[model samples]
Target: MTFARHCVFDGSSVGSEEWCASLDEKDKGDWSANEAADYAKYCVF
Candidate 1:
Protein backbone atom coordinates (compact mmCIF):
# COMPACT_ATOMS: atom_id res chain seq x y z
CA MET A 1 0.00 0.00 0.00
CA THR A 2 3.02 2.28 -0.12
CA PHE A 3 2.01 3.47 -3.53
CA ALA A 4 -1.37 4.47 -2.22
CA ARG A 5 0.16 6.14 0.81
CA HIS A 6 2.62 8.27 -1.08
CA CYS A 7 0.73 8.82 -4.29
CA VAL A 8 -2.89 8.76 -3.14
CA PHE A 9 -3.22 9.35 0.60
CA ASP A 10 -0.16 11.35 1.66
CA GLY A 11 -1.14 14.41 -0.28
CA SER A 12 -1.77 17.76 1.38
CA SER A 13 -5.36 16.58 1.21
CA VAL A 14 -6.60 13.12 0.66
CA GLY A 15 -8.05 12.59 -2.80
CA SER A 16 -6.43 15.73 -4.14
CA GLU A 17 -6.38 15.25 -7.87
CA GLU A 18 -3.57 17.71 -8.37
CA TRP A 19 -1.31 16.11 -5.78
CA CYS A 20 -2.01 12.64 -7.01
CA ALA A 21 -1.39 13.73 -10.57
CA SER A 22 1.99 15.11 -9.60
CA LEU A 23 3.06 11.90 -7.96
CA ASP A 24 1.62 9.89 -10.83
CA GLU A 25 4.17 11.50 -13.10
CA LYS A 26 6.80 9.45 -11.25
CA ASP A 27 4.88 6.33 -12.18
CA LYS A 28 4.21 5.65 -8.53
CA GLY A 29 7.90 4.95 -7.93
CA ASP A 30 8.10 1.38 -9.14
CA TRP A 31 4.62 0.02 -8.67
CA SER A 32 3.84 -3.00 -10.76
CA ALA A 33 0.84 -3.29 -13.03
CA ASN A 34 -0.72 -6.00 -10.89
CA GLU A 35 -0.38 -3.93 -7.75
CA ALA A 36 -1.94 -0.94 -9.43
CA ALA A 37 -4.79 -3.12 -10.62
CA ASP A 38 -5.40 -4.41 -7.14
CA TYR A 39 -5.39 -0.91 -5.72
CA ALA A 40 -7.89 0.08 -8.36
CA LYS A 41 -10.04 -2.89 -7.49
CA TYR A 42 -10.05 -2.49 -3.72
CA CYS A 43 -9.61 1.23 -3.30
CA VAL A 44 -10.84 2.91 -6.43
CA PHE A 45 -13.63 0.57 -7.35
Candidate 2:
Protein backbone atom coordinates (compact mmCIF):
# COMPACT_ATOMS: atom_id res chain seq x y z
CA MET A 1 0.00 0.00 0.00
CA THR A 2 1.08 3.54 -0.66
CA PHE A 3 1.66 6.17 2.01
CA ALA A 4 -1.71 7.77 1.31
CA ARG A 5 -3.54 4.46 1.60
CA HIS A 6 -1.88 3.13 4.73
CA CYS A 7 -2.01 6.56 6.29
CA VAL A 8 -5.77 6.31 6.31
CA PHE A 9 -5.66 3.38 8.73
CA ASP A 10 -2.67 4.44 10.81
CA GLY A 11 -0.46 7.30 9.73
CA SER A 12 2.63 6.01 11.57
CA SER A 13 4.15 2.86 12.98
CA VAL A 14 1.56 1.28 15.25
CA GLY A 15 3.03 0.45 18.62
CA SER A 16 1.81 -0.48 22.09
CA GLU A 17 -1.80 -1.76 22.23
CA GLU A 18 -3.39 1.26 20.70
CA TRP A 19 -4.30 -0.24 17.32
CA CYS A 20 -4.61 -3.78 16.04
CA ALA A 21 -3.04 -6.07 18.57
CA SER A 22 -3.38 -9.04 16.25
CA LEU A 23 -1.03 -7.44 13.75
CA ASP A 24 1.47 -6.65 16.46
CA GLU A 25 1.33 -10.19 17.77
CA LYS A 26 1.86 -11.48 14.27
CA ASP A 27 5.35 -10.10 14.21
CA LYS A 28 7.77 -12.19 16.24
CA GLY A 29 10.18 -9.26 16.48
CA ASP A 30 10.33 -5.51 16.00
CA TRP A 31 7.84 -4.32 13.40
CA SER A 32 9.91 -2.72 10.71
CA ALA A 33 8.88 0.84 9.97
CA ASN A 34 9.26 -0.15 6.32
CA GLU A 35 7.00 -3.16 6.81
CA ALA A 36 3.95 -1.21 7.94
CA ALA A 37 2.46 -1.50 4.48
CA ASP A 38 2.98 -5.25 4.43
CA TYR A 39 1.31 -5.53 7.84
CA ALA A 40 -1.69 -3.66 6.55
CA LYS A 41 -2.17 -6.35 3.92
CA TYR A 42 -2.07 -9.12 6.57
CA CYS A 43 0.73 -10.72 4.54
CA VAL A 44 3.21 -10.45 7.40
CA PHE A 45 1.23 -12.99 9.40
Q: Count the clashes in each prediction.
A: 0, 0
> After superposition, which runs of candidate 1 have C-alpha atoms over 4 Å from their true positions?
1-27
> Candidate 1 lDDT, tens digit per residue, 1-45?
988777767654433555345446656657678646654554462
| TM-score for each model | 0.35, 0.22
Question: lDDT scores for all predictions?
Answer: 0.56, 0.54
Best by TM-score: 1
lDDT of 1 at 24: 61
Q: Which numbered prediction scores highest in lDDT against the true structure?
A: 1
- Model 1 global lDDT (CA atoms, 0 to 1): 0.56
> Where's the lowest-lDDT run of ten residues in candidate 2?
11-20
Tell me which residue pairs clash in candidate 1.
Answer: none
